[model samples]
Target: MARTTSLSGFPEWLPEERIVEQHVLDSLRRTFELHGFSSIETRAVETVEQLLRKGEIDKEVYGVSRLQQDEDSSREDALALHFDLTVPFARYVVENSGYLTFPFRRYQIQKVWRGERPQEGRAREFTQADIDVVGDGTLAFRYDVELALVMIEALSELPIPPFVLRVNNRKLAEGFYRGVGLTDAPAVLREIDKLEKIGAEQVSRNLQDTVGATPEQAEAALSLAAIRTEDTSFVERVRELGVSNNLLDEGLNELAEVVGEASRRAPGKVVADLSIARGLDYYTGTVYETVLVGHEQLGSVCSGGRYESLASSGKKTYPGVGLSIGVTRLVTRILSRSMAQASRSVPSAVLVALNDDASWSAAQDVAGQLRARGIATEVAATAQKFGKQIRYAERRGIPFVWFSSVAEDGSPTHEVKDIRSGEQVAADPASWQPPAEDLHATVLRAATTDD
Candidate 1:
């Protein structure tokens, strides 16, 4: 007989990690609501045609079919699992266009499936946190900058350090591509996007080979991409680099206005990077990618951009800008480096023991009382020995345990033990309150690295 392994790319976590996930998600929902973003969830499946409306992303879409049961005659016409939340949201908005308010601000946190090869941070199935504001006819540029600021503010509340929000505009990239004497802007962008994976020399080589760029022109484009600045001075730098064209100037002005507005609201969070060429095809304006401090090698933990129009019914158009944080990726990074640890295995603050079969009902009463007082608790299912019950409580990381003691007349009293300190104290079942800080587990500081 052989043991089996769990499926890959469909990761499942234990109860403690699930609690942490819930905490993270709840925090996100609260933050979104605080800033007046409504929430909605769409069905998991969409017709293959609806998904293929956007061009490049269709490659990663995981189409749904029942193949294991009836392989011979399954309808091969695929209905794809959404690769990201935005596409489905766009469809949703179009389908329900008449009902939604203009500048519809919505937040969706859901699991999306992609059929990509699994790696360290990339998953076949993962969760994304998306926020978008779609307007009826034309979306406002102010919301574009404001939404980026809101994301920066929300993520700042997390334990991670100052992260860089790398931004660029497709319009800017297009302008620069044309200025470099290239006709197909997107083809050039595809080449530039590989700069991180392929070295600068290879990127230059690819540019020349594929997009027909002269070596000098390729080097100039690379120089423009590498020009990273912390402030508005980057605009003047691009202009001085003499990449001035009508499209370039227009894009530069938009970038400046967006970065300026974002800075006023969220200082030191946004940066204009010419190098960011988001692989997605639909982003027509500003594009963004976020990197955690000192973890740039892990790549963008969050990435998205502006879509000029996602939903079209031939009579209506909706343009929107948004970004999604890869929640699981960030969590995986935190877990891998031991930057954070759960303080407990379960949500329980206390465990009431079944000292003996005779004491079971009494233990249940204590558990109920604790729960009624808003403490999470569990009663032992079987009447195990005192030592065994204590070990069980400790193993579960239930900080406190209660032992029900029968009165001489068979009534009940309670004794509680704090496992960490090895201290036992007489306690009243109804009145004893755990210290405020001990009511729920708290995230503890892990061992630090100088970096």
Candidate 2:
């Protein structure tokens, strides 16, 4: 037999790490549900046409097929693992439009696959927690405002680095580009998307060679991307550019609304960064990019935006605004940087100690009783000395050890020892309960000197 190796980009967490991951997931789910967002799931696979219908991301898509294909198989064209949740969700909305409500609010948490080169915060397969509000034909700008509010609220509860959400609008970027004589704005937008990676010089050259943008035009594009404002003063700043268009005005009004409302509700959480022209072509309105306070190098940890027409039929259209948090990226950073800690490696709050081999089944019965009362309990696996049993519980971070006994008159009694504090107290299995905070594994952050 040979030892197996870990796949390069597929992340697998140990039990302790998974504790933090579950905490993050639970916190996200609670926040989303609290906001009245219903949950829905889409199939992991979608037709290749549905994925490629929007843009040229074929290289990042992983195609799916069976090991052996018959000549007469019913495979139409081909299928691929979805690279993101939005496209598949779009198809789902159109397919289920008839039965769905007018304003559909959904939260989808699932693994998505991407074949891109893996790096820190990047993976071949990852999980995304998304909340989208989709409307029939026309959606309101308030949803855009609400999206930012929900994200800031949800992320504030997670154990990770502080984050700042960067917002921009497609109309602003496209109008700015068009106002600068760049007709092929999408190609230019793609080039600008790589501005951080390829540097301003390379991006300018690509803009010129790829889209015939001159040096002046390239500088203007870079200039627009460089603008970042914390307040609604961004409106005046864009006006300072001295370039005006009807679409630009529309975008400015919408951006002002989102930024103003976001500032009023969740102060200092979001900012207007004009350079945030997201890579997706479907985004027709406001866009988002997020960076941690100290982890800007890792790029956006959460991102999504408004799409004017994502889902459509011959007569109907679905417009939406959404935000997604990359759960894997978040938990990875938490573990790698020691951003947080799981209070226990396992869920057991109390380990039932066995007095002797004859008491094994009795301990099991006691464990069941504690579990029935909503305490996480696990019976000792073997009959061991009390010291050895307590040692076992200590190794697993189990806080309490329960010892079974009977009174002189044959009445049942149990005592649980708190390993950390060395305190023993009488308890009844049906009535005993761990403190609320200790009832389950908890995720905590390491204290910092600044704190």
Candidate 3:
């Protein structure tokens, strides 16, 4: 049978592209570590019961179970691949509450499975970078502020340009809805969240038809949600709506503090967007969605919000706040636009050519010396022609090639060449070094067609 093609939205990049991906991951990990967020990885699978505890994720779950494990038909083991890291992390925090430190700050970067249909940036199998701070009921507000700041710094490290961290307070949205005579909080917020997709008129109509709102009241609520003041004016404007519910006042205060703190850290990065209602049903406090400036049409590259309770074991509540970067989406966008890149591979500095059968062992000594000096060197597997060996290095994007030659008098010498420049130099393998910049290939801006 003919080989099946790679399924769409399931991307498999070449070695060079993999290098770019790894570089992105490495930079993200470094930023997380710099902020003192410890790393933790949960298993890929969790019980369906554990996953469905939060009602919002049912549509995207990819269930898993053994195909032939039912011979006895008496025992059962059910599991599903995790759709997001936060839920599993919450479960881990609850179960291992005793072992973990209070105010736990952890960062997890892993592949998550979503059974949703594919789109341009959305994939069936994708990676996400999530950082969260869960506490033993005493998380400082500073942690919430820092989480957004750290994500900003991490994403800024990528080749992509600036992105806006659109933030809102769920409490603020709920409070305003209550003041507007709406009772069901999630249902109301869900409708408002569609404002970006559906026009304000349609959103207001939906509010009237679905959530029982008068036409004028729906327009007023949509106007409040559409309010996008630069700073404290957001709070002032929302209050000006004259929604008298105490809950609205409280939500406005909570968001005021969060936006105020985030502004102090990153003056222009965070904005109070009342209409930025994330569809997640769990968020009860501050919510966030980040969009690249030029790529706004690509939608949110990172998004999350504060959850009042992630796990309810019928006994206790776990309040938490976190954010996630859609790694696959952002990376694919970068690739398509030639926004970033990486070296061909992880090999350090040199590729030692195989001169002849007799000189193979001698070349090994040179490679051993280079390796001892912290250089990555590889010897050719076969003694091919000089041209063939040079092409091998070029194909791999190996910057330097070490050529070995045995003189007629049985003396051995080695020369190094920079394949790109076609410059060759005599060198002692033990002491030679490539320029620091030449040691690694980086993402280069694509040249114009005319060039």
Candidate 4:
């Protein structure tokens, strides 16, 4: 085995843990495709200018350049590894607008790099599963609801604890802030985003001191953030606050539509949470933040929102709604807490035992037939003793082992043993089948234990 050193912010999983991660990626991909989202992967690096156009994420962007440059070489456009899939997808849309149909829906599952501190659920390099729908010039509000529903369905397929998709609208927030006489709605929103981390009192203070809000305005902002409901009643509660604006009315209607439709479709999975003011400035409409039940400390395991103008050509603009699942973060928490695990560390379901050097060719022939039937089979390496070969299969978590020999009638005989149950039975390589459950490595949810 080769010696290894660990990197602080970059995570590498063991074989079993990787199995769990792959299962998650596969599940999300299937769900995305079922919802009519085609998959696409953008290049890893993008121009720094294109990246910095979004928001103040410059601190997290990892710049890339040649290690050695010729003294006389002209400087090239600065490039950096993408921090998220949304920005790159935006650029891709603009670059390929002519070829793609309107309302292009895409799903991307790829590794993204961010220069952030190493902490639980936060990494410098991680995999994110993203789904977005972009339209030329204009996008429909129905897509906002559709993305939420699709994300809720995808997450429902995972083995994690139950979750709630908390959603909000930026238009509602900005409109409310403006109604309260605050000119810099974005500045207020940035402070409000920290309400959960820094507490309502500190956020209120920041609103007054940093964002230049009056005491009443800060109080109203806190009040709005406190409103959360599982149904459309949140609209009535906001109306009771006595704030009114055309933008606020539009936001209220959009949010009600999302919550109302999503509730009917996926009950107990969606909420109208006014406090979910996503810190990103680009989110123009509905924003989402999901937390696993009983694991709130992990923060939002999935998050995203709507962007009205992230992608645009000279004559056309692509507005979109999207959501991303932090695959690495979810997997890290699942493994650390024993929430789930793989049934086996390796992919092989059956191991063929060689009786002797002469039987090696026969073992290979049997393995070939098994592989042809879609069974994952491997032949022993050195034709070791029967017991020793079985032990090797056991160590690898291979459930079944095959033995072949010549019968008294001079006919080839094959038998397979279920090592876990110690049951051996005659089987033909061309016809025998393992139980469906044992055909592949499966992700199993760990049983709950009393504290």
Off by over 4 Å in 1: 1-5, 68-77, 264-268, 408-411, 447-451
Q: Taking the tens digit of each residue's C-alpha lDDT, what string does model 3 give over 1-451?
A: 1122279656677667776777788889999999999999999998887887765767799978677766654313568899888889989888888798877888999999988788768888899999998877556666667788888899878777678888888888888788777888788788898988888988988988999988877877788888875466797788677788887787788777778877887888888888988876777788899988777878999999888678544566667789999988887877777776665554556889887867788888999998887777888878999899888888877888898787799887789999889999998887987887765665554442111
List the candidates ranked by TM-score, beginning with the highest.
4, 2, 3, 1
Per-residue lDDT tens digits for candidate 2, residues 1-451, read: 0111278678888788889899999999999999999999999999988898886888999989888866675546688999999989999999999999978999999999999798789999999999999999898789999989999999999877778899998888888889988888888889989988889899999998988999999998888888888889998988888887888888999999999998888887889998888898888899998888888888899999999777888778899999889998888888888888899999999999988888999999999999988889898888888899899999999999999898899998889888999999999898988888889999887774111
Candidate 4 local lDDT, residue 50: 88
What local lDDT does model 2 show for residue 288?
A: 92
Each model's TM-score?
A: 0.92, 0.96, 0.93, 0.97
Q: Write the per-residue lDDT of candidate 4 for residues 296-379, one digit (tens) a residue.
A: 878899999999888987766899999999999999888888888999999999999999988888899999999999999999
Worst 10 residues of 3 by lDDT: 442-451
| Candidate 3: stretches off by over 4 Å | 1-5, 69-76, 312-314, 345-348, 407-411, 444-451
By lDDT, rank the candidates, best first. 4, 2, 1, 3
Instruction: Give the number of colliding residue pairs in candidate 1.
Output: 0
lDDT score, candidate 2, position 217: 95
CA RMSD of each candidate after superposition = 3.0, 2.4, 3.2, 2.1
Q: For residues 261-349, could you state the per-residue lDDT of candidate 1 as single tens digits?
A: 77666667788888999887888888989998788887898788889877777867899989898987776666667666677868798
Q: Rate the local accuracy (lDDT) of all candidates.
A: 0.81, 0.88, 0.80, 0.92
**With candidate 3 superimposed using the best TM-score fit, by how many Å does residue 217's alpha carbon deviate from the native?**
2.6
Count of clashes, each model: 0, 0, 0, 0
**Which model scores highest in lDDT?**
4
